[model samples]
Target: MPVPPPPADLTTIAHALQERLGPARWFDAHTHIGQHDPDGMTATAEEILAGLDHAGHERALTFAMHEPDGYRQANDVVLEASRASDGRLLPLARIAPGAPGALEEARRCLDAGALGFKLHPRSDAFALTHPDVDAVVALAAERRGPVLFHAGRGIPQLSEAAVALAERHPGARLILAHAAVSDLGLLAEPAARLPNLFFDTSWWHPSDLLQLFATVPPGQILYASDMPYGPGTFSAFAFLRCCAAVGIPDDAVREMVGAQLDRVVTGADPVDLGRAVGSARLGERSLPLERVASYTAVAMQLGYRGVDATEAVALARCGAQTTGTGPEAELLRYVDGLLARAEERLAAAADDDAPARMAAVLDAVVAGFLAATTSAGVPPVAL
Candidate 1:
């Protein structure tokens, strides 16, 4: 089957910028390939590879989903699968910080050829300050590897512990996944001092990402898709749109795509993309995109909360009815089409409760944010 091109408006935008930026090898800094997630999300290595092909990404940093039973077997599954991917997949062992033998398992996986580690404070039911966590992170520092944390949700005390851990282990590349939304303001402040600390762009909303891009060093922001939960192509489109919104230089955006990750995976220090310009003075807004952004936020919130978003989607379409004719409005038109398609998909789905239908809704939400970003072409600060 032919791989579909990215959404047309986004593709058009990339084409226009390619002249100055040239092409970049995008690396998805966060992803998963496993079947035993308690949350009912499963993704195969094949699916991730296909997603990479579709998104024009060159490689990915993949690990297992949450393994409540034990991560030893799941870690092996990831290592074995990544071994066969011919460099397209770089394996990261998932460690449950509270689990017994957690430090041993981290060592075992790294010795078994895994590149880094992933820890989920929310799912693993442990905090970063756990006694065993320092041991694992210390091992990562010794090996000069990455230790990616799930910062997707707000967890109590995680921010302070994470800052302390980064300060302690400058050798380990500590990546706070999902835009580090839990403590973007606080973390962004000290991120400049902690050269080893980083953030990955993997969350679903634009508001969080806007602040991340605005307030964090571009060098410290790695492009991530959080595959299985978020499709690679869709997330990549959002990345491109956000990059354009901030008006960063072509070279810096190129680095964010993959080049920077190439270094991070090896546990090497990141190349400087300069300091962030404070988020307080972020410039530009499009009324049309503003409507779409509001709709997107509400829709994602409802969907994730297990609420039906049909009424919200319908109400959103009402506001998008009159976007005039420019680049921003043009993207809004694309967003409107995606929303209509989502409605049609929802209507036609055999099982209304199926994951596909839920994914359809998310697709439109992400597209809405992508469109919203088109208006802020001259991002207030360069870094």
Candidate 2:
């Protein structure tokens, strides 16, 4: 089938920017393509790929969304897309934090060719910094994969919480969606500090993006279009134009589009490649649970109060209190005990009406401990 071209204006935007910024091919960092009906997004994998080809993007990290039980449907659509694209669409599996068989499902997705895990805290009613986040992170790391987290500071959102959670997982590479726009002035400090941290530009206004562009290194910035949420090609082309308009170099734009994201999608650590992306932050800093708790308090006030939010806050605090220096065995035991308790809670909730809520809380607590332990000098990947 012949792929469609973008709108004339969009093509112009890309060409104009390429002329100025030098022609560096781009890789879209984020995208969601699917068909939705009562049966969830019913689009075939080929249709989604057709859209990608039509967009003129070299590659993309494709994801999907639907209600709770729609994981299967969504996964099927994405898996098909991944297979058809032959790696152009890096299929990512979306799993509600508290869904039954969530971990098992993640494994299944990876086996079926998902490149990473896709988490939407807002829609799933959980926070990235939730305690159980470690389990998912651990699973991804075990597979030598990365995780892309949806981040934004709006209704039912927890962009701030998601960033905080990434801080805890040093070994788990994180893709922060929308780059928390709250503190534009200080965003670079955090971006430069987190070695495994990456950001995607999808919906921010030209001004906000320019502000971010001035501070954040291009290697950390990914060109993304949260399709179905944004104006698709129009929005993506506008972002590219804005990047060029802001005087960002052409090579930088290329890096933003795909060079950097390609590394993350392929799970290639810059450090391993001797790229020196950045030194790990929170290394010398004591990321006590108190700091996380303080943020959670403010977050709750801002309406971040869901099962995942509350549980992550509590677990971070508890993790800070429980684990301390001693024999390595002792530390491991302590963590094991904490995880065991979490499992008990999860087991108990299996038959509960609100299994997702209960599971989210448990996962949040685990993620909290993992973050806290990392702050105390443990590798975020240790979990």
Candidate 2 residue lDDT tens string, 262-287 = 77767676432212223232234244
Worst 10 residues of 1 by lDDT: 1-10
lDDT of 1 by residue, 194-303 (tens): 98888999987888888888888889999998887766766776776676667666789999989998898886667998887445444667676677778867877876
Error of 1 at 144 (Å): 1.4
C-alpha lDDT of candidate 2 relative to the true structure: 0.55
The TM-score, computed over Cα atoms with residue i paired to residue i, of candidate 1 is 0.89
Residue 321 alpha-carbon offset, candidate 2, angstroms:
63
Deviation of model 1 at 29, angstroms: 1.0
Clashing pairs in 1: none
